[model samples]
Target: MIYFDNGSTSFPKAPGVGEAMANLLATSAFNINRGGYAGAYRVADMVLDTRELVCQLLDWDDPKNVAFSGNITQSLNMLLKGYLKKGDHVVVSSLEHNAVMRPLNQLAELGVSFDAARAEVDGRLPIERVEALIRPETKMVVLTHASNVCGTVLPIEEAAALCRARGLHFVIDAAQTAGVLPLSMKKLGASAIAFTGHKGLLGPQGIGGMLISDDFAKELEPLISGGTGSVSDTEFMPAFLPDRFESGTMNLPGVAGLNAALQYVLKTGTAAIYEAEMALSGRFLAGARALPGVRIVGVDGLEGRVSTVSLDFTPAGLDNAAVAFRLDSEHGVMTRCGMHCAPRAHKTLGTFPQGTVRFAFGHTNTAEEVDICLAALTGMIKGS
Candidate 1:
């Protein structure tokens, strides 16, 4: 199958990811921190190595501040719910996925409020508009590094600078840009960055984390309270970096797979991956533009975007879902259709209710696949 749904979850995950998980389950799948044996120590060491790898990838210094969760959704919950109190206000972009919007919505009902900096029709969130939304009570500014629907890379660096100058905590949801884009926590001056393993990281699902600064880490409270295996003597969660937030037996096998996947990403370099995926997107865009009645969503060019491209076939009298169905069932081209869990983003891009067909290319996709997809689209449009 020709997979163009990498924005949802990467397929054919990094080499050795499956093997690493299998090896851990087969040989030494011991619980770290709790188990007091040699196998447990070895597992714990691997976990530490994984944390350090995350730091290396994000250009962070403190491995201790790295905290893991089931996914970025959970990580965002931990960070948002933990840090923001009843009176706190936050600033966000209109292009946020449900991951960010849902939590903030839940917070709004509890007296915490948020404002969305409007994005342009092409899905670009301008820096000046974002600056205007930051109120005196705004405690933090959260931004998705890129849009999941249209793949428009947001102005995270500019927002970070704004937040830094205003003394507001800058939080980044790097769900879309983590593996495909070169991100430096030091350079961005972000308080925390939440990332998922399954998307751009090319790792297995159920493993994601956050790299938090020391000051922000101290301010954020733990959403969950339980034994961290480090401080079993007391009922209170340990007042430390990771143990403060990580409560329960962690996903060791997922961590193992993510470790292997991260190693592959580091070796392959994000610059090379970005170039390869963008080349595929560029080809697809050039061909799609030539198709009659086909509307390319978002920037319509390669600038300030990732490999994800959304198409509106409404002018051709084609249903988005129907197109996606035919692409999968007939042409063997897999793409995602609908709002992509970002209603706000859809509204911003003016694709609300009637969502576009999204084709998200990955490093594993090729020029041949793009050609096949283009041919499939051509045939569908011509009623052949």
Candidate 2:
């Protein structure tokens, strides 16, 4: 089957991901940083190595600043819930996923307010527009590196600079762009970056985290207070970097899988993977745009986007769900329909309420698969 929903979660994960998980589960089930036994030390060491690998991939400075969680959503919640307090204000992009919007919404109920800068009809969020929405009480600016629905890459560097100049925390949701796009902490100047290992990192699910700057880490409170296996004498949480945010027994097996996946990504190189996926997506876009009823959303080219492409079947008087169903059932071409958990993104692309069919390419996908998908789409549109 041809999998085109990598934006949701990567399929056919890196060859070693499952192997590593199995190996860890079989060899050792010990928790990290919880004991003095040799098994515990070994697992803790591996976790630290994984943090260093993450730092390398994101060009972050200190590995200790990276905090692991079950998923990007968890990481985002930790940051949002910990950093923002009552009476604070925030600025967000119109294309942000519910991961960002939901947490902010919860905060709003507690008296926090947020403004959303509208994206261009084409899905670009201008830096000046974001600045215009900033208020004296605006404490942070949250941006998604790329829109999960349309794959429109935002100018994160400019936005980060604006936030830095205004002394507002710049938080980046790198859920869609982490493994596909090259990110540098030094270059973007972001205060925090939340990422998912399963999506673009080519890792298994249940492993993701956030990388925070020294300043952000210091001021941020812990989302959960429990045994970090450190400072046991006191009831309060540890004041250290990672242990401060990490509580209870960590996901050692998932971290092992992520370690294996990171090794694969580093060896293969993000630039090559991105180029290949974009090529496939570009071919798909070219064919889909030519079809009478298929309307491509957002940018049709690879200039400022990832490999995700959204299609509207309304022009052909076909149901979006039916189109996706045919692609999976009749053609063995898997695609995602509906809002993709990003309602705001759908609204920005003018496909809200009736979401579009999304085709997101992965590193393992090929031009041949793109051709097969185009042919399947051709037959579906013609038959309709």
Candidate 3:
């Protein structure tokens, strides 16, 4: 299949990812930070290795500040719930995914307030608008590193600088750009970054993590409360970095795979991946531009985007879902349709409700696959 649903979860994972997971699960998968045996310690080392890779990818200082979780959703929850409380004002970009929106909406019931910065139809968020939204009551700014719907890369550094100047927490949701875009947690002055392991990171679905600065770690409350391996005797949750947010048994095998996937990303470098995917995306947009009734989204210069690409052909009266189903069934082209769990982003781009057919590219995609997608789309048009 010509898979293009990578925005949801990356397909064709790196060569060693499956091998690493199998190696651990077949031999010695153990609950991390819980067991005292040497085997458990060795298993825990894999988690540390993954965290180290994440730190290096994001240019973070200490690896200890990274904490493992389920996905970007859980990581965002940890950061949002941990930092914001009653009456805190938060700033969010208009391109945020449901993960950030839902939690903030729920928190609004407790008298918390939020102000949304305007995002252009091209999916880029204005740094000035985000800064302008900052008030004395603004306690945090949560924004997507890139729009999964349109592939627009937000100005993380500029926003981070504003947050720093105004003394507000700068948090980034790196779900779509974790391994596809370059990041510098230290240089950008980001207080925290939440990322999913399954998408651009090329890891298994069940594994993800969040990285935070020491100050944020100190002030951040624990959202998930329970046994954290350390201070097991105490009913109170531990007040440490990883132990603070991480609770319950960890996904060791998935993290083992994550370690290998991150290794692949480092060996290849995010720059190379970005260039490759941009080239592919450029090809798609170019091809889509030539066709009649093909509405291409996010054709902005390769400078401010990730690998994701969205297009619509609703003039043909075949909705995104119908086109997606046809692509998978007849043309062997797999893709994601509909709002993609980001209705607000779609609405901001004026593609909400009806949504758009998405063709999210990845490192493994080739020129031949692009041609296949183009040819398949053309065929779909011709057959109609």
Candidate 4:
């Protein structure tokens, strides 16, 4: 299948992702820091290497500050639930995924007030609009780096700076932009970043992480309290940076795969990947806009965006699920068709009540695939 659903989880991951996971499961099955033997210590060393690689990727000075988690959803939950007290205020955006919105929504019932920055009807969240929503009581500013459904990249650096200048903690969800975009934790002024390794990172599922700043690392409480490999002597979670946040036996095999996947991106170069995907999406966007029944979402340009682009064909009386089925069956093109778990974003973009068809591009997608998808879509529109 010609997969264009990388915005959800990158399919057919980088060359070494699966191999690395299999190799680790077969050769290095020992628990980290559990035994003094070489087997256990070797596993621990690999995990440390993964942490250091992540630090280098994000330009973080401290590898100890990065914490491995299950996914962005879990990391967001841990941060939102752990850090926010009963009365803390948060600043969110209308462009947020449910991963951020759900927790904050639940917290609303518990006396946590929030202000959501509105997005333009085209899905862009202006920096000034977001800045205006920051109240005096806002302790945390949470936002997505890019729209998972529409590929509109927000000004994360500006949002993070707004939080920093106001002394509010900044949290970013980099589910769609981690490997496809140039982002530095320091440069972006983010206190903590939740990432999904399965997406742009091209890693396996069940393994995602967060790169936390030293300041936030020290202050953030452990949301999931359990047995960390370190400090087993006490019931209290260790007061260390990563150890405090990480609990239970870690996803060592998944981390190993993630390290390999990240290595692939580093070698292939992020700029090259971004350029390729942007070109692909640009071709699709320009072509779709020329079609009669096709309507594109997001800004007219691909600036400040990843490779994802959403389109609306409901105006032609086509059901999203039927269109998805036709594309997968008649054409070999694969795409995600739904609200994409960001109903609030759809509401902001004026696509709510009726979700749009999303076409997310990956590094492996080719010009031929784009041509084929456009041809199939054009035919569908005419036939409908």
Candidate with top TM-score is 1
Please name the candidate that would achieve the greatest lDDT relative to the true structure. 1
Candidate 4 clash figure, as a count? 0
Q: On residues 258-300, what C-alpha lDDT tens digit does candidate 1 reach at each position?
A: 9999999999998999999999999999999999998888999
lDDT of 2 by residue, 80-162 (tens): 99989888999999999999999999999999899999998668887899999998899999999999898999989999889
Candidates 1 and 3 compared by lDDT, better number: 1
C-alpha lDDT values of all predictions: 0.93, 0.90, 0.87, 0.86
Worst 10-residue lDDT window for candidate 4 reads: 291-300
Q: Which residue pairs collide in model 4, if any?
A: none
Instruction: Report the poorest 10 consecutive residues by lDDT, candidate 3.
Output: 294-303
Candidate 3 lDDT, 34-78, residue by residue in tens: 888998899988888888999999998688899999898999988
| Local error of candidate 2 at residue 190 (angstroms) | 1.4
RMSD of 4: 1.1
- RMSD for each model, in Å, please? 0.7, 0.9, 1.3, 1.1
